[model samples]
Target: MIDNRDPLSRLKAALQVIDSQRKILSDSKSDEMLVRDLSAIVRYLNSMSISQASHILEKAHRRGHDQKKNQAEDFTQAYNLNLDDIQSIIDSENVTRGELESIAVGRFQVPKGSLRSIGNMEQLKMKVSTLVQNERSHQTISKLAGDHKYK
Candidate 1:
């Protein structure tokens, strides 16, 4: 359970509540006033200094936070992205530390603390390769065992 006493948690919860309300409206025709109101509320909250709005949005909006997905699953959004594709890009380009950090943290939702242990591109690539291999193996096993959860 989430701690109710934490201010950050409270703020996150509030944002999620607003988001759910918006989701409900999406089932019907576009309601500009209501949608704008929700967006305004988000803007107001973002303007506040109590906490970074991104921290809340990251938890609420990102696919990586889905219960079944691992946080480090980065390339699922791409139809064609793969290990060799990424490797080729890295080899052909001067990928900076900042760019790597953004992909790891911003896109993948990988926690900064977890990324600290991986000090170089080679380490990150190897870690991802291992993860993908394991995931494929697990999927194959699940399919063979008729585990519909994976399907």
Candidate 2:
């Protein structure tokens, strides 16, 4: 139960009123009703004290930020993905890297510029090919040396 005199209670009641007005506007069949409902909501908001309005806005902003952080943390914990890994997947899939990076930094809270140095898919493929060739050469030399020693 909330006391009617409490700031939080008043804010909650105001939000509920606004929400009801929105519902009425959505269901309204006439332009006049729509305009009236919208004007009422606007007037109610305008009449609210500056301090109360600011407090509500601040709480809403903080709540949204906390939700994003929590969601990002949960995703990382479940999928074991870091920014580099995500970038690699995005590159491999041939998707837009910039958009994905923006989402990663803005919504997922990944540190900005973390994947700036990650090479493209083509570069990664070339590096893998070079490593494979070097490994093959090393194995061939080792096999030849062993054969000669056994002769």
- Alpha-carbon error at 60 in model 2, in Å? 1.4
Per-candidate RMSD, Å: 17.7, 13.3
Candidate 1, residue 48: the lDDT equals 58
Q: Which stretches of candidate 1 lie over 4 Å from their true place?
A: 1-109, 147-151
Residue 5 shift from truth in candidate 2, angstroms: 27
Q: Estimate each model's TM-score.
A: 0.32, 0.35
TM-score top scorer:
2
Model 1, 1-151: lDDT tens digits are 5556555666767877887787678666569788878878866874655456445555665655583364334324322355455445445547655445445454345676797789888777655545546656787898878865554
Can you write out model 2's per-residue Cα lDDT over 1-151, one digit (the tens) per residue? 6555466566667677776777676677547767577778766776788587768767877999997787566545524554445445455756454545444454355565665655674554443334345656787899999889944
Lowest lDDT 10-residue stretch of candidate 2: 123-132
Model 2: residue 63 alpha-carbon error in angstroms: 1.7
> Model 2, which residues run further than 4 Å from truth?
1-30, 81-151
